[model samples]
Target: MRALYQIAFLACILFSCGCSDSNPSPSDDDNVPPPSGTSSFDIITQELSNDLTIDIYVPRVENASGKYPIIYFNDGDVFKGAIASLTSYKFEASSGIEPFIMVGISAAGHRYGRYIPYNDQWIKENWSDYSPGSINYTQRLINEVIPKVEEDYPVDTKRRAIFGFSLSGLYAAWAGINYPEVFSFSASMSPSFWVADYAIFDEPRELSNTRFYFDIGTKEWNYYVPMIESLENLGFRYGKDIFYYEVPGGIHAESDWASRLHIPLGLFLNGTPEEVEGYEIIKECIPSQSTAGLVFQRLNPIVTFTNGIRYSLSTSASFQVVSGDGVVLEDGRFDTKGGSMTVEVSHGNWSEHISLNNCNN
Candidate 1:
């Protein structure tokens, strides 16, 4: 998502102009090659005034089956190399990242008209064709583009996500806020959050159900990081529900976005074996009469416990250690579930009984 200079020079947009086929070489010892995948040629879309071109990447597997998540790229034309590289690295058998299909929507010149909201006075001053009450850009994405992608691919619309850089980064945030049902996850790299005079902050909504990622270069605009921090202040769960990073020497450039794309992608698409196993254990633990008879070990800073089974409590926890007969053993905060035979936890006004297997079932 590069900023537009003017309508006449749209062809010469600064970032995300081309696609790459090369795989990024990972230096980490843990890196391994993923299954081979094919990159589809440009697909035309009739949704917007400017016919948008979408490039799709599908991973090739021996038994390629099941529905995979879909990620929409805002400035899709560029970052093809980075996308391919990360897909390979993360989807490697050991990486634990679930396989997904990527749909890249090229930013063929309407970067300003489409990505930036008309509410921003600064943007309106720069671009004459700005529409004040129109979402023609997002409309085409939802009404037209996604349906077209789904026509030819098996995509899990329930787990949809979007990513963009700079102005398109701003669009990512806007889409997530406005259409949570469509885009439940978003990554905004060096987002032009300053648009519309920080209109995003004019009573910004909490993304309780969304998984968001934000990152900016340490040396970019001075106010950018603070604005991001303000967004975080709206009560997003840091590691669980949201992720924010300040790249040490990162800049507002495609190279920076390419270099760090995997960080957000992995967080959204992949999980560590521990995390995956923990998710299963928690899912199983939720069923009635489920039990894991083992000594418990607790992991802190995020309110989690593990034995042969693991459970991570939400941030809004009010844990109670209760006896088998329903007597309260301890009534404390989220960290009160340790060394207990039975514990009742409350989160966001909902409660559940977690049976700790301190005794034989």
Candidate 2:
């Protein structure tokens, strides 16, 4: 999102003879490229065994900026455009999650023809002709693509991620499962794990540093349920091996996946794949029993810095950052909503205290 700036220029025409017209500050009307300070991109063509075209989205950054994480999608055709559509960049522009360089690999149509797991006879019998036998695509991604993406982008290979849906969904899981050494996080939406014979978990070894997100709609599910059930069972056995989400009245359309796309995207890009069971949201809120006129309308998630210091919260609808330490750095209203916030804070050497005002009299 670009910031809107309205610079008004007032000209006093005291000696313009006949007439005087008010002229405001001329705005920047050039067709300049959006600031590439946050992200940029280039097309990569690989002349390997499987000649492939990789669409890399380079996160705009400086050399001093440390490495960022990578999130790759297999069915690039379906998932690439999804990046901008999901406003992932906008979310990054927001304060909570960290920015990531997203790479969407367009399936050049060979998607179904080439990428499938196990190449088992049962897969061929049940779901079309699934030629499985160590998906070479995974190898390309891990060995070649990873290197290529890392070479071009400032990426931390240790924090790589992969995600997909349907056919590629299965590819995502299989690649991450079979080659855990490559992807740190993975998510499968309505994966065809049921397409194969032996269950996904049963055919695996101890998973390391790999977190999975399994999601499916509850509606329009006649055969998908079994796959979901099997995954849930496996997750139970494997603990945080999977992050399962049973979307109520879920559908197979893009609308459903669209609604839930951010879940996996965020998780893969910036979440700990920890085993979570019976999630209970504990909202320790200081009720807005304001007896005064000033009050907050909304309160987003409180931000926690890696420095082990937690920010103070104001209310439910939105929280105002009172201060970094205890001194006020910003005077008057400081906002963080609609991409901005109003606040008053103090500045100090290392730490200061946050003093919040407007508590109902």
Candidate 3:
């Protein structure tokens, strides 16, 4: 059932009613013409006998000439297709986003080793398969890739940004946190925060001018909420320097991430938050539907704004047992007594009621 739903969602993303008329399909082949007003090329970097392919995309702004900001992407080969397509669409539509150079750094064959942090214990345990080269990879990117690009192109070095998803998303966050001087912005899409029991949080972080954008799908497990809270604890404000988005009905697939890529791109390039006129609250019981004999674990209230940005109000929202014998635990979970129960959840000016029935049919 879930698989079928995901297929349908992907179809909506790929072939939405007006998408064909508005944005043409992007080509995956390098030999094909690149996005309009954008020049594309590739570079090879050899490190430790591994050849890394880096794809570069530079958007040409006619009648306006100045140094453009640059965004570096991990998992170059996989994301370049979507990046190229979106670049073309934005250009054709006159999206008003500032021009920027894109650098897509391919992980090549050392993805697992290069994406994970060097101090991660998982890589140490699986030393044979994933060589100890994460630190080296980071160094190469900072010292090698950035230098090569800056030397060849007219770029705004101060406004550099890093972007990645999943494990590579973790890398993007790590780089931004550790080297804010190098990357002023970082966009992490569904990062693997559970890696090495969340050891990334243990690393020391200093307050800086760096901005971060984080997001996860509602259909996916809530592994990134804690990371967002951690950033808040470090003095990062929502919709300001740090942004967290809960994508409604989104999944862990690349197609899902590709569809909403414009959100981060607009935020970083234009430096404006989408205006919110209204919002809808989506209540989801952790298990959705559970066996009658099972206990209710958790209830998640996701607030999705009219701007299409969603947020999980689980930690900050107030949860109260409205009517039922069920008890609201101190940890915010409801204890069902094999009967129907209703809970009222409130956040800011919004309130919603969620009813659960554990009674056997």
Global lDDT scores for all candidate models: 0.54, 0.47, 0.62
Q: What is the alpha-carbon lDDT for the whole of candidate 3? A: 0.62
Model 2, span 1-361: residue lDDT tens: 0011111111221111101112111112112223333334433444434546666665444323477877887655444434444433433344445656777776654654445665555434433454453466776776877787788667887788887766567677777767777788877776555434424544445536677776644332212223323444444232234455545455544445655676776666555433222121112212222223424221112222342222112111122355342221111223333332233322211222233333232
lDDT of prediction 2: 0.47
Off by over 4 Å in 1: 1-50, 62-65, 78-90, 126-129, 132-134, 224-235, 271-361
lDDT of 3 by residue, 32-86 (tens): 3334664423333323325676777766552145787888998776555545655
Q: In model 2, which regions exceed 4 Å deviation?
A: 1-51, 61-65, 91-94, 120-130, 220-241, 272-361
| TM-score of each model, paired residue for residue | 0.59, 0.56, 0.73
Cα lDDT tens digits, model 1, 173-268, are: 777777777887888877767666565544346645777777655434323324334456776654566555545545555556666787667656
lDDT of 2 at 285: 16
Clashes of 1: 1
Q: Of the candidates numbered 2 and 3, which has the greater lDDT value?
A: 3
Q: Give the Å error, residue 37, model 1.
A: 12
Best by lDDT: 3
Question: Worst lDDT window (10 residues) for model 3?
Answer: 1-10
